[model samples]
Target: MTSPYPPSTSISPSDMAAGAKKPTDLPQAQIDAIIRTKRKAREPKACYPCHARKVKCDRNLPCDGCVKRDHADLCSYERPSKKRAQAFESPAGASTSSAAEPTEYYSYDDIPSRVKPENTHPGPDHLGVGGRVSIARDEWDNVRSRLKEMETTISSLRMGLERAEESPAVGPDSGSVQSAEGASRSKGNSPEREGIHAANTFGKGTVHLGSRSVMAYILNNKSGSDQLQALLEGGILPKLGLDNESATYPFVDLWSSDMSSFDISAVCSALPADGQCRQFFYYYRDISGAIYPVIEDITKFENDLELLLAKRLEAGGVYREDGDQAQTPFGTSIAYLGLLYAVLASGCQSSDLGSKERELTSQVYVCCSYQCLRMTNFLSQPTIEAIQTLLVIGNVLSYNMNPGISYVLLGMTLRMGLALGLHVESSRFSVEERYRRRHTWWSMAWQDSHFSLSYDRPSTTAVSQPNIAYREGSQPGDFSYFETLCKVISLALEVVRIRMLSPNAHITFSSFQEYQERIRQIMIEAKPYLRDPQYCSSSTEHLERVVLKLHSSYFCSELCRPSLKPSAGRADANTVAMRKDCVSNLVTTVDAYIELHNISYHAARSWIALQRAISSAFLLAVVEEAKSDSHVLTALRRLEGIIAQRASSERAYDNGDVATSNITSSDQGMASYDPVTGATNPRGLSHPLSMLPLLRDLAPNLKLNGPNL
Candidate 1:
């Protein structure tokens, strides 16, 4: 192309001698390139909004500065047109005269869009040995997209398969799946589902009382379901001469305004006489205390009790004006009274008194204790004493067949302990104080773990906190049973976390074996404290050993029981061995519980002991091979006989003629007894014996000749 500009009017002599080209003497292409480079260099890279506002721009499609300024719609990077370049070249009127009308400015929307380049080297669509087939870029892209979609589908299916493998499938024989499908179909037929309506009513939510709970486990078994259904349909209670209405006991209304009225005189009057109080305190110390050991200083507690009673006597059983001043620390505090009363109630409950007297006395004291606790505002200002009272109350309730209440109360108690900083070790505290805190914290944790395991619920107390080093006893060589119990419970809680709370969804056989080995090691380490003659010399120590032994076996059996489930599938040699071991441990647990009961009826009255026994008995009854075992039959019969005798004694007492009742049992001298509490009907067997019917059905050959009650 020809040059568009004229030559320069002047040139340097040095440039001419060196033969370098002048700017005005260059070719048209070189001149145009120089103009384009200068134009490009001066052009703005930022959007017009950012450039006009004089702010830094990210230079994105919609520059950040423009977006922040709310002018993203006008954020254009368009530069001035070539008209400006032409005007620059012809600064005089020569070019301006030709376009003298007006200058026109183009908006961003007026700018034409750039055209995309075509693919000149599109690859072959298919490759072959002989030749290849050429295709468009769009066709290759389409093929890639389909392959990506298929890959995604395959990945989703693989994940679903893995999840299905982790969860147990419902067997065809089990109607649960069919029932669920039927329920879904029924719901689909509802009018509410046909259209979207502004409904005011809310649907009821389903409650999942844990699938692993003992009751749920039994209900899941086919035979157990049939037996329980038959009993329900046949009106077992009516046949046993018990009214359905009589079975339900009215719960004590703690929230009532009447219960809110706290009377110091009433509490003092409700308490047993001095000697009787001493006896009851001793009972708690020997029975519940031996197991939990929440009370750090028994002597100090007794001294405080004496002071409280003496002050009450001096005040003539009324609130003394100077009582708070006289007993600055313990005696005057409402929490202390609650603690004392709770201990007394626990003792009274464990006593050999007649069922009526025991229940009445314990209820009175329990009410007094609760009133005192309410008055103290324990929820807001929980103390060591208040927590102690709750623990005792929970212990009493657990044995009284109120495990649900106990579980809830224990959860509250654990939270209270955490609030009191009992979980943390404080150097400012005295050695005795530190020990008390440790004992209280671990006691709550141990109880919480047991209840959570029994209920198949998550524990409120986690093992990760506190970070406090556990001492077996405050003093050396003490051989604390509470410590042993805590250790075992801690190990069991670990297994629960792995098996239930783990992300893996299911426990493998190898993992189960690993947990079993860990439990075995813990038991081995605890054997010395459990079996040493020095520790087991006293009666309390002996009882502790027996209870510990029972719990140890129960935990072992529980670890194995899941393996025996129908979901566990066919049994290998190892599984068979584990089943045998489970049966053996269950038998041992039952035997130990029977022995514990024989030694001290109060000791065996614990809900945990009863639960373990019942669970083991039912498991034995369910296993085909175990049903025919003579030893199992003998133990179950003995347990049944004891339950029947207690029920008959209770019936006789209800008749209001205890002396005239024809009771030929060996313990006939003892008053009418009810080992389990909270019976539906006072004249019938307690809830614990409701499972006996199932046992009877399973072991028909064995003579469990106990009455229906």
Candidate 2:
């Protein structure tokens, strides 16, 4: 071999046995070039999509997996970069050694120059590779992190389950285990004592006692309980279904109806003529406005209405006094429209329009008001005007025999008022502004308290500081009526709060008696001012007096209702006497309600007054049936007579007999009206012996004799 080959290419016996030269003996540039070539040759065999998804491929131009996935166009292979490969190779002496053994091929890691000593596995950017491998690495790290988190969560849940299994089972008498555990943790106190402590703590936050409702008390009585169950089972009472249609207004799906079709022009055209509008406004100002006093500036409101009407005539579309475009959705103009329509609706209800006309016209205005409010997105962007509009709408709905809907609207209005900081007194504002805010917030509180009592639900309106001030002198202004009303309602709410205390707590009979005394004291203080000859001159003043009396009597009876239940333990002589007094208060309450209906046209159609009257009568009937007292029976009969008369009048109105149905004074001595001041003649209205048929059905001893019966 030495004789045939050149001296430079000579192969010795040792070199032949070794098969190849060592990689360390080679040049660095040559080693890098070889590693690059090996990596290029290790390219994926499948198409790019298949490789990325890690799926099997047939190695076709458009692989079967890619075709199935509807991505055949993206099935081309990714070729190794020639420029990257060339950058690593030295221009000269970069050729491969043919004598180099095939088994000694270099891998990427074997190239010492490509990797740093500190980091054996460099990033893809450092390695000059494609993004596919980098993405796969990142996803793998994410999966590992998620698995660790799941393991931690599972361990925590397992520990909780083990603890739960070791705990004692709960029982009705012992209360919930969590409650027991919470009680036991409190500094060595017994579970029962701790339970009472916890309940008392919870009761401090509650504003109403749902369990102390009149219906609940009646059901607590054995006789009334059985009769009520039987009546409900026999379907004697109307089914209380949650449907849209009602006797007062037809069902209109304002929530789902197409709002794009709303026409401002059509809404304007539907408004009452200017003269009629003024008449309706005056009617509301004298009746509902006199009571609530929510609108502080009547002159400003009237001027705004006139300006709105003028602008509507000039613009031929939605008009904003603030120069906002008609196309703006949540503009002041839309909210103003809602407010105006709501006022008009309430006024219409208070007006002496025929029964059908009142319902139909008020219904139209209400729907329009709702549409405008929705268009303005009042929930997200509440304003003072929007709150006022909602208050009026709630009042209108409450009287329209829709108290449930009215309550829901009142809740929304409360939230809106809170959002505008109306519930809080701010010294930063002007005196006028502060008074206006106080007026609105107190009105909401008044409405909310009454509604809460009516429905036996919790009130959302919390009493805040800086109470509305009463005038100092004996002479009473318009504010005097509202202030007195608020005082009475506040006392009633306090009674409700006390009743919410836990049964296990140590509440004394003296506490309830104290509340009853407070209610009486407020009524006494109000009587002198309320009966002032100068103050009681207007129909509004007279109406206020009657309403104040109704609330006082009803709430006084409410404070004594619990003692009537047998489950309340044996009653002492004081409790027995209190029960008799409660019955008398119920009679007075019902009578005052009847007088309210007689004096005011608005009260005649008010569902709130009607509901209060009926509930009081029912409670009276329940007590009379339980005790079989002749005095209670006589009081029940008188209430029944008044209700029967009102029901008959409503039926006549429904039948379109306005002449006979119109509440007026007559020689026959029906409900007498004072036409001059719009109040009832105190001497004319009388309660003849009668009975409600429903009450008779509920209590068999009740004798039915009225025309309604």
Across 374-464, the per-residue lDDT of candidate 2 in tens digits comes to: 6777889987777888888887776554555676678889888888888677789887777777767777877787766754556666444
- Which regions in candidate 2 have their CA more than 4 angstroms from the true location? 1-209, 233-256, 260-262, 298-334, 463-466, 469-479, 499-508, 524-529, 532-535, 569-571, 625-635, 658-693
In the predicted model 1, the residue pairs found to clash are 247-680, 247-681
Residue runs of model 1 more than 4 Å from their true location after superposition: 1-208, 229-261, 323-330, 426-428, 463-478, 503-529, 532-535, 652-709
| Model 2 error, position 310 (Å) | 7.1
TM-scores of all predicted structures: 0.64, 0.61
Q: Give the whole-model CA lDDT for all candidates, comma-separated.
A: 0.59, 0.57
lDDT of 2 at 676: 34
Q: Please write out the lDDT profile of model 1 over residues 1-709, one tens digit for every residue.
A: 9899986556456545544555455444334333432332233556665654445666665754555444577766664444445647554545543455233433333332221223464222121112222334565467669879996886688667546544544333221211211222221211111111111111222212344544445445555655533443343322221112122231353435575565555555566667788778877777767766777777888788888778767666555435444422224676787888889888876665655676667767777787777878889988988898888887766655555556667888988998888878789988767878877777787777776666566766664445333563434234356666777777777766653443123445576577667655655556455655464555566678788888888887877766566555555876777777778888989888776665565665666777778767766766666767888777777766665555565556656765644344453222222222311112322334444554566455344555542
